[model samples]
Target: MTKPKTQEPVITSTSELPTSEAKWVTLRKVNYTDQTGAARTWEVASRKTRAKSAGVDAVAMGNVILHPARAPATVVVIQYRPPLDAYTVEWPAGLIDEGESAEDAAVREFKEEIGYDCEVTSVSPVQAADPGMSDANMKLVMVEVKLGEEDGEELPVQRLEDGEHIQRVVVPLTELYQRLVEWSEGERKIVAAKLFHFAAGMEFARKEGKKYGL
Candidate 1:
């Protein structure tokens, strides 16, 4: 692949783009089907190619579930995706299926990965992670739940704790900032959604506290 050019902004109004944004090229392996009602699977490579320079050509959804804590705290599940060794901490995120809304996908990922249902409160403007090399960007949305019972839904965790790795743990405001810094430094990566989710949940918890005089 040739060197990717820079400064091709589809549209911008958020934080500084990650260095990786300029270096994520992937291919679309379309599974042709005869049935119109059929489904297909899409896969991305761990490395970039010359063709990926145009854009990332992919999209995904993510969620950060806020649970009840002593203080206004939030939950962050630690999981490790393939291609990136070492169990890096992250939120419940996954690729948007063939036809899935970002918000809806977020909910599905939450349920399957975290085993819960949630409602989206706010969505961040769409942003790119690696822009120059790959057009791949992400639609980040935040969500919450004051109190809800687990529906006891059973979903396949094909990616966590079996062949995959995932660990769910809650983090308070006291430690959030530090982790964000740690993620930024770690080579694996610290997605913006994780940080944004923490901010959004803490905001809601604060408001809830003010109302109850906590």
Candidate 2:
């Protein structure tokens, strides 16, 4: 009797990876008065991805794609995060370029990061990412993609930036929760809050036999 081979896990532990010393973020202090008229100074960090015309933190966009034609799956990316000294599992996301809309940013980032051209279905309102710490805001965009039914499908070409190490992972929607659980138990951890909530919601909807319109 022959044994069947199992597929390797999509997530990988990269805690030992080294990061570049290039300065990608900057910190500054701002003094503001509160409702009680007390003046206080707060430190804030800013990313170089922000556009010059932006007053607040630059607009960022994230995509949640569902492929209905092929094997049911969602697009995700695993990339090294220097701050945590670990690789993070997150959706394809990027900062909106000058003269670009949030929807366009999401579409462009999806292709650049995951190498798939997706059709934007919906865009959410601006949501804060740690208002108490950073002024960064993101608009979650939903897109629908189709991956053909084939064993070992051809991987798409990525257009990553210099110093970026992103690995595209096509996660089956049916096994998202299980994968998350496995990650939690394994060495690598899922630190993206949006990704966690999205997976949880999807699993809940699946259990309740409910269709997520988004």
Candidate 3:
């Protein structure tokens, strides 16, 4: 069967709205007294879908793909971000369902986005997604996926939703940071901050290890 070509999403127009009219995310003015005793009001955006059971708005998967003879790799997804009106390279992520846990959300999102089942290895504490701009928070869930020799070169089919046109890129662990940087420059793509920070941290640790002979 021939698959239908995906169309690139474009913003036809943009407009401003009062906070009260927002559905998915709402803006708020936080009033508080500063350390110096001056009153302050800060504007912030908050997600209306934050699940109390999940204790977070979202979960991003830090997936490590293990192969018998190849270097370990990770999956990064590229998709159009409407707010930015640009394609973004980001960790496979999704909102946590009302009744789901972080680990479950990680596994489900990884499968839906990357087409690989993963084992949740660790879950980071809830972290701010954009502290200065929004009150949205997410947890980084580290997961591992093992691939058989036959599956090494084949890309699995993604189980994405109708409007989700995601392209998955498998990147070797050692080359991730450089690869992301190259993608950002060469393709003029937006890289998600959390994903960039993760790659940068790994690269930093690797360089430090070599420097100290660890």
Q: For this target, which candidate reaches the highest TM-score against the unseen true structure?
A: 3
lDDT at 159, model 3: 90
| Alpha-carbon TM-score of each model against the true structure | 0.51, 0.72, 0.93
Give candidate 1 misplaced runs (Cα > 4 Å). Answer: 1-69, 148-162, 180-214
- Native-structure RMSD, model 3: 1.7
Instruction: Provide the clashing-pair count of each candidate structure.
Output: 9, 0, 0
Residue pairs of candidate 2 with colliding backbone atoms: none
For model 3, how does the per-residue alpha-carbon lDDT over 9-71 read when each residue is reduced to its tens digit? 778999997778888999888999999999999999899998888789999998899999899
lDDT of 2 at 19: 27
Instruction: Point out the worst 10-residue segment of candidate 1 by lDDT.
Output: 50-59
Predicted candidate 2 versus true structure: per-residue lDDT over 1-214, tens digit per residue: 5934544335445453222433666566899999999999998765656655432333333444444355567767777675665667877777778767777777888888878888888877768877778766777788877554443455678888876777777777778777866775657555478877878887887776545444
- lDDT winner between candidates 2 and 3: 3
What local lDDT score does residue 86 receive in model 3, on the 0 to 100 scale? Answer: 84
Task: Return the TM-score for candidate 3, rounded to 2 decimals.
Answer: 0.93
For model 1, residues 148-201, the per-residue Cα lDDT tens digits are 344222333433333434556555565665666676587655545545565557
Worst 10 residues of 3 by lDDT: 180-189
